[model samples]
Target: KTTNMPERPFDSENARKKQHAEQSNNELDENSPTNNNEQSGDEEDDDENQIKGNEEEDYQEDDDEETPDFTDDEYGSEFTDDYLCPELMAERPQEHESLNNVIIVDNLPKVDPAKLEKLKEVISKVYNKFGVCRNVYYPLDKDGKTKGYGFFEFQNEQMALEAVKQTDGYRLDKNHTFSVTLMSEFERLTQVPSEATDIGNLLSWLTEPDAVDQFAVQSDDPKKTMIYSNALSQPILLEERSKWTETDFVWSPKGTYLASFHEKGIALWGGKEFRQVQRFAHTGGVQHIDFSPCERYLVTTSARPGNSEAFIIWDVITGQKKRSFPVEQGSPYFK
Candidate 1:
């Protein structure tokens, strides 16, 4: 017991100091600077995370404010009501000229060579009478024959109207009658001379040649006429005749051909040479004729009293009938 107790001998100051040291160590552990630093760092990290979350929320709000909605009524209302009707929206020209610059002559009978020259002379006289010197175009048919009607353009409306008034119903050839009127407005725009002031003058200039020849008037048979020319210093006379028996003829697009109808057939002639290049026979008289714009085909109407009306389309090249249709009484001009 003495040996075991002898090792436990400790000084009072040493034991007390050891106990104080232990207490000091416990106090230091409770309030260490390293722990305080770790706590402060955690608080700083939380603050930084909260600030970042607020910034993210602000950015999302900004993005939502920028989008546009198309379903609103203000977007497309004005564009739909303006351009729908084209005709009403069309703008008319500010300056408009009179329609009297264009001249249309109707109701002319087929003329032979002698009467053709006379008709040319009469047209010249008419132009001279009006004191205009514009060009006149007399388009002929495929047979070198004049379509009964032609157009004359003047330099101005006054001149054109003068020609119309002077020449309408004015006789040039014995059996031919003429009707003159202002051309339609559309025709005036397309065919009248751009700078012409007098169409009658222009026509007069076209027919004046260096020489004149004379030949006998062919016949009064109302079907045959003779024409003579001596421009080449030699007298030449040719008999002019038309196979058509009906009135109201039209010229081809180029004014180089004539289309006409007759009691028995339809005929087309080239203007330069009086040769019949096309002919279509019909059981009845051919009353009307019209050519397509492209000149690929022609339509003819055959109507006789007490008989059913019929229409035929013929190939321009071969003069062969391509189609036929029957028409009722008082039907339209074209079926």
Candidate 2:
């Protein structure tokens, strides 16, 4: 049954004709005259057409080579925001006299020793756009390679911050990038804090009575103040406040008198052995004390429960009461 029907033969002649038609269409010029009445293209037009075709091919080829984003890993991200240092976004200083305002820039373009000054000038000028730049530092080796980084000290922290935010991943030239961070971060990560021993050396002999004088009073510490006592022949602890002290302990202007608070009142201590000088008595205890500018007068305030607060001014030299004033509880010192 399968052999009963004859197979249809393939059409080779029709296929060849169809192929020839497609070739003819591909060769036709887009701007050429479609009808016989229209003008035909010349040799000059053919040359222009070839040039336009080459330009379009090159445009297509460049799409493969262009960078999408510098921050992407495709761009070797060293100079990109993705690779920025963590210290760059550090918190502000927690204390005064801190070196937090300094910005440490790293991984910069390395230049020859002779070109460092020129490079420094360029870097300074660039960072100045962000804030008031105090100084710029470029550390170099013997060969003068920029250690590949530098430091920028802004007049204040805000300027340093502006530079970090605006120019973090900013491309500096073609190869170099910035790694901006705090100088304190660098020191803390790389080294221990340096210490000064000069202070301890100067006060080494303070344990003797004759060397006694200036002392620091701490309200929170066990002993309100520390001073040299000749009796024990060593630094001795005195004026220990057994109860929780609410007021601060202060020293006289000339360091002659150490004033501390207690359950009784404010006790002023003086002498080589840190003897008791005088006690300004208050019924409930003194909460605060202030010495006049010349140390001739002292003012003490005691605020007790249920009754009016009382303030007394005392003559420092004779310990005589100068004035007494009473005011409402929780009221600030009378004007």
Candidate 3:
């Protein structure tokens, strides 16, 4: 029981060989070219796939960037229908000739060449307050003098309109007043009206076939005023109008005009159709009217409240008021 079996001798040489062999096999496995080649091939394949995937993603991004996005915010909803398809678009309309940006200033003071620049400076100073003046053109006479009128071009139509409205009838001096108008209106005003061609001679009524004297009558009904030829057998109606006269009517001394009284003033009617030939504007009501013996002048009397000038003398043919007289404390209303 006490005798120990001889301990197995440690096999140092055999153990060392086995361990060395195992370490060599392991190193060989790690350093083998075939195994390394397979591992590297797998890595290469993965890299190629990764690169291809990146290239495909870049191509997709390029395609997205190249495609046009026709959105409402960028091109508008009607761009395709109105601009792209030319046949679907309507033809552009022609623009009318307008002088909307040009103004005509008349009644300016005429100046010689020496003072022309000074006058222009003065005019520009006045209009520059309203808007920027693009150009100022004053026509020159043969003697190199500035005309009394000029053309002003403004930056826009609104400036021209404001200039015309504010400066029309503007008094620059005691003797000079501005007659401002749009160039467009100047063109229209220069052309005569179409009705001017249709106007017949004023003395056509004097040539009646029977030499019958024509007389106008105001009926009891306010609307029924009539003119008649004083025929020998019967009164022949010539023309009639409703509410022609307000209070009274008169005939010119030579029967050249049939005058009708109106609250504003008097209306002179003549010719074959008894058309209105002229009108006089008296602010207050006209109570009495008298024509000169020769029918060359008309005198109108009005009793205007708080107004001293109640008498107006008008040139009949020209329809221009020649003079006005103020009422005195004890003087008669009319002379």
Candidate 4:
């Protein structure tokens, strides 16, 4: 009856335990005169015999203690307590680990010793038609039979999806149907619950969609102007970069450019590189600056004790000064 159920990683360990129990009972029955065969002397069978012995030892139950019950109160809710493993209704996944680019294939027809070897050889070539396979795994029971399932890890996610889409319904043989899904699909607890962000998951935070836009926090104590993402999506550091004497940082009206003031001039910057885009040279930095509402004009002004004060307007994109007005140093008429 269990043969009809597809083999899934979620229920694998439980199925093994149930099968081993049944096998053990069969072994006890065989101990009667009907199973008095001599131990094999063939060296090739040694590994298989050893594996079987190990499995028997692992399943042996101690007479004194009771096995624990599967319940949400004890284990936490993740997989469905019902249909996830149809045949093994009470079974549960041992762990939930996502093998990102890997996929599981199952429901191959059971074959004899000779046919099983042929199936393993052909199945690999069949999967490889879609993409490069990084690794393959097929475990055999003690009897050396193909357990009707295999796992193929591809070089990338695209290859895995191609394999699944291309072969999902095709039959491996007349007796069984093929089943395929990402290894993540079997994981009952794919997400790790966390109370706060820490080193373990910090790298993932940097890749969030909001991490690209930037802002700045300027201060003299740090000696450096700190440029950071306006979204606070990543760590921003100003460090020791105190070079600008200008009191304010001006962003162009459209925000396509950020202007920094220094004793020499006003410099415009933009892009992912955050490099200086253009410089408007001034002997003494501007006292105030503003971008026209349409962002086509950049206006700069200077206030000084000398007889000459200056107000200039320039083309914002070309950095070409279009006009300049000289004002008397103490011009109360301008205020």
| TM-score of predicted structure 2 | 0.30
Model 1 backbone overlap count: 32
**lDDT at residue 316 of model 1 (Cα atoms):** 87
Evaluate residue 84 in candidate 1 and report its C-alpha lDDT on the 0 to 100 scale: 63
**Candidate 4: C-alpha lDDT:** 0.69
At residue 284, candidate 3 shows an lDDT of: 74
Q: Say what the RMSD of model 1 is.
A: 22.9
| Cα lDDT, all candidates | 0.65, 0.67, 0.83, 0.69
Among all candidates shown, the one with the greatest TM-score = 3
lDDT of 4 by residue, 1-335 (tens): 45676668869899889999999999987785545443333444787889998877767745446756666385535667474667685453233322657888888756666787688788887898888887887767788777888889888788888888888887766777788888877655355544432223212324548655455777776555777655554466422246643666877765667788877668876654455666787556677788888877887777655514377778876677888777764532333
Clashing pairs in 3: none
**Candidate 1, position 329, lDDT:** 70
Error of 3 at 11 (Å): 50
Poorly placed runs, candidate 3 (over 4 Å): 1-197, 330-335
Error of 1 at 142 (Å): 50
Kindly give the stretch of ten consecutive residues in candidate 4 with the minimal lDDT sum: 196-205
CA shift at 52, candidate 2, in angstroms?
99
Model 3, span 143-261: residue lDDT tens: 99887999998888899899999999999999899999988777667976545424477778667788888888888765679998899999999888888888889898888888888
Using all chains and alpha carbons, the TM-scores for the candidates as numbered come to 0.29, 0.30, 0.45, 0.33
lDDT of 1: 0.65
